[model samples]
Target chain A: MAFGIGSGIFFAHMPFLKLNGIPGTTYRVMPGLISKRLTNRLGINFQAESFGNNRQKGMDELDRVLDRGFPVGMLTSVYYLPYLPKAFRFHFNAHNLLIYGKQNGEYLVSDPVLDFTTTISPKDLERARFPKGVLAPNGRMYYPVSVPEKVDFNPAIKKAIRWSGFENIMTPPFLPFFGSRAINYMANKVAKYPTAMDERKAILFLGNIVRMQEEIGTGGAGFRFIYAAFLQQAAKRLDNPELSLLSKEMTGIGDQWRDFAFSAGRICKGRQAGNEDFKSIANLLMDIGDKESAFFHKLRKVKM
Target chain B: MKANEVPQDDSGVIGGKFTGLKYATDENGNYVEVQSIGWDAEITVLSQAWDEVNEQAKEALEKVKAGQWSTLAYHSTKCMMNEAMLSEYMDMSKAKVKEHLYNPAAFAALPAATKEKYAEVLNIDLNELLRAE
Candidate 1:
């Protein structure tokens, strides 16, 4: 029933997997929160192998099973290659995915990275090698294998593999979920609303403004320093005694504000200085601001 | 539909002026689309710069030149992805932009010098670019 529920949802959502595709499953050896969510949805058992120990022991256990002619499922390597007995070296990353049923003297393997369903001959499996640094200090790998029957539970082994309480196989990664697509479609629909567009434009403008500030800290340092020096000179220009003392003070403050504003403008200008997207977006914002100001002026005139 | 009507389909939205201008037809008959202008342009610029620096570095094999190239590329990419103009144009989430740029497949086609040039133009580090898994 558990498998049925998971499979039903998985199969329903991702019909693309059935189009000239092989049936397969996915599992995470060391399940993180995201992996746990996947497990719940897919009904896959979370078999947690330790990065520190037990991985070698698990590999050994797998080898024993393979020797007994039990169909092997893909091994999920959380960290480092499990120490499989020499006979199983052929399966290292080659028949990396084990098949439950053989059609043409080859096991169908599902590769996550390759995004293709591959059929590997036993000879090819023999020559397959683990990735470089697979045996190193902190390397991690995950494999999916075919099993003769549901994985038998040795209490300790089950405990080691059961990172999460859930236990069911998951659909392969290539499967598409209709629910997600639907949600995305709806979101794109909502984005077309004028209010949403305006909000997006505003947020984009604000984000650009913030980014411009950060750029000045990096590549715009020269311009910033020059702008600062210019402000200092402007401040010095307010040294006229002929003007009222308060006027002179006001002039100094004005000069300081001018410098600050100029520095800010320089930083903003420097951000999209050469980038066309920035130029366009900046122009759009300016146009929007101008239109808004004009609208306000027209409203005031009408009120008068 | 009226000109101001909200676009209900991909074609309507995609054909809109803002989005339409983002793509262009190249001489090779491929549609070259600008995913993110500021960020891509910055990368192009940094990549160009790195090409020069790398040519000199290869002759001298100077670590400093290499380091400068790396820093330039890294800073630019980071700035581009994190900053507003480039980030907004990204097809994926903002967080994923950095990862996408770092992906090996993205640079697989470029030669070492060309890749370095691209990094310089983008204001990123070559080592960092290569290291992106």
Candidate 2:
């Protein structure tokens, strides 16, 4: 049910970049923004509202919605979600999940990051919804206020493709921390980790990238596979074989991301050395940047 | 992303948190249903992060015991937060929160309304908020 939301289905957010000497450069455009953009473009009627300071009222509204048979999308802190394994939990607060129904005192949850649905107590749900962090959920929730019986697919597909491709490849010159440039910026920062911070800190930093990519549903391969899936759908919808080929290429790029994560993991565990230095890691990232740059560059030129 | 690949072994740590029904391809490349049990490496990383939090909580508890910081500080750390985070959560200015951290007497004397806000934000009871431990 949550998969119908366009954010995770379309472009995967690649928001791991920072300005030099700046702390907390890890930011994404986020699912909320994407949902808004896609829904607006497709003219799919939806409403995403933040409950802000009145969390009790938010809970009431969520109960009302669930009673009305709408599975509501909610922003929450992964760390406070008690159902998640403690080892998989982190401070990230922008995690999205669906609250479909309630029984007894527990809310049925459909977390996109997981492979199966789960349940959470109202108390834990409340805690997860309101967590202290950089990107606190603030009791934010979204739902499809209304959806079209039939979607006009051609324009939607074209627009989504164009928007995603342009956003990732041809980001404005003023925004240095975007698109391929952001990847380059991250590569530079990662290369300096060994010298810029203590050894243990450096490895933790490496581990965080893996955590973001694989553990937190950041899309295994930084969202390349999801984008590929989107392209695959586009290929079928538009009857364009080029898109299918591009999807295969994107999947290969996703493989590269997995490889990077695997290497990073080994280094974090101190199991691999001699060839897994910071420089090599940086180079691997640059290779991804190159492939992504080429892919998006070509994607933007698709005739549709 | 296969049913067989889902690790059922939860020998040493917590398990049984079901995600959702996932789709995987069989040997014939046809879609199949699978239930992901949870990734082991991701759990290990989460455990490591929790250990760090536990260490911080222990330090904060000692400070509370010594009257160097308010019990609120220790509780905040226990909630996986620091002063900056607690300030954000409580919707109080960082400077004010920091002041409260240093002055347990003042914190204890705060209005019930304000105390309630802290307890609610931390997802704890009022008694737990005031407790020294």
Candidate 3:
């Protein structure tokens, strides 16, 4: 999995940063890191550019690159992308997509999560590229500059897996809002939300979490599940039985995350039956945190 | 998840407007791309979010009907924008945007060109900018 090889699975529950008035949780590394880390690990020559205040110059450069027949990745805001579903468009500035070709004043877009390719008008694309505030894209784009003819995969996969295993398993004690710790941290915080915050805000906060978890681009699965898929593929090539077993366990953990989303969704919809309240969901999160804590540690010890 | 096990439960929230790709195990136990027509959990959560947004817009529309807030307030809330964002887009200070949203006297004193700017940014005509229909 390019995702796991890039250490994409993470958990961060941020209360200090507010998004749309909801305290948000981030499930992956920052927007650009996965590709950056993955390319670096694979020794691929990658080139990226940011236009800063020079957007027209950025567009010209983008045109120049596309003229050379390279599809470039761009950081964009979802809110101005008219091709997205009405339900999916928000002021989110970290959405990434590919611009492959231009035709008749529209750019051909291969948005990562969508089932089909779409097109965006130049003006709309410009609006999506420059949403103000909070991790603004600033007309950023990246493309691979060159590719190596030969490479070894087994060692690279093992190194990446081990590195990511430690990354998820070893967040420090003081910054409790990070890594697997945040899963447990949120488990504790969910209990206080009902009493600490107003009813609507509490519900919206949980909804925001669910949005991050099941966001359409994640292929309707948690990163753990995606990582598990990666592991299964890797195990076959590596002939590693231990990884196969852990992959199954990771799938189970992913199921638990879906259960969390289900229970939290019920609460947000005001359909929580007798057992679907905050306490039960908090317990569910604790159970998930424990499983993940054990899983990552074991993953770190895998013989590779 | 296995290909067959992927949820087909429609939450009545997209109604076929959107489809996403999922990674699921194929019959041979290899991973493959499986298109999903929205999952139950995601639909439930996103519906709650949209409900809140639309509900707030409705309340703002009511407030506009009652002459409590200017139509700028109604348009901004309906578009899921806050004063900070609107201010940035309008190139006005946040306090000035607040006045445009709330203070009837300040809004009424706006010149035609200023109103045109708001109308353009909000993607509404001059008539729609005057009041919420």
Question: Which candidate wins on lDDT?
Answer: 3
Shift of residue A162 alpha carbon in model 3, Å: 1.9
Tell me, what's the RMSD of every candidate? 26.1, 4.4, 2.1
Candidate 1 structure quality by residue, lDDT tens digits, B1-133: 0112212222221122211112222343222322211222222222332333344435332322343333222433333222222233332354444433344344354568755654543335777655422
- Per-candidate DockQ values are 0.03, 0.28, 0.63
Worst 10 residues of 2 chain A by lDDT: A18-27
**lDDT tens digits, residues A35-113, model 2?**
7766876777887777776779889989998888888999998878877766556567788899999988899998876
Q: After superposing candidate 1 on the true structure, give the runs of residues whose Cα lies further than 4 Å from its correct spot.
A: A1-35, A53-109, A113-273, A276-304, B1-133
Q: Fraction of true inter-chain Cα contacts (below 8 Å) kept per model?
A: 0.00, 0.21, 0.60
Across A1-304, the per-residue lDDT of candidate 3 in tens digits comes to 7887787877889888787778768888888999998888888898999888577988889889999988999999888888877788878989999999999878999988676788888888887787776788888999988878886677778988898789887988988888887899998888777877777877887778888888877755457678888899789879999999988888888878888988887787774423238888989999998898899899899987
Docking class of 3: medium
Shift in Å, residue A261, candidate 3: 1.5
Error of 3 at A272 (Å): 4.8
True contacts kept of 3: 0.60
Q: What's candidate 3's DockQ score?
A: 0.63
| Cα lDDT of model 1 by residue, A101-143, tens digit | 3447665555432233556554333223222112211112232
Quote the lDDT for A254 in model 2: 71
Angstrom error at residue A37, model 3: 0.8
Candidate 1 chain B lowest-lDDT run of ten: B12-21
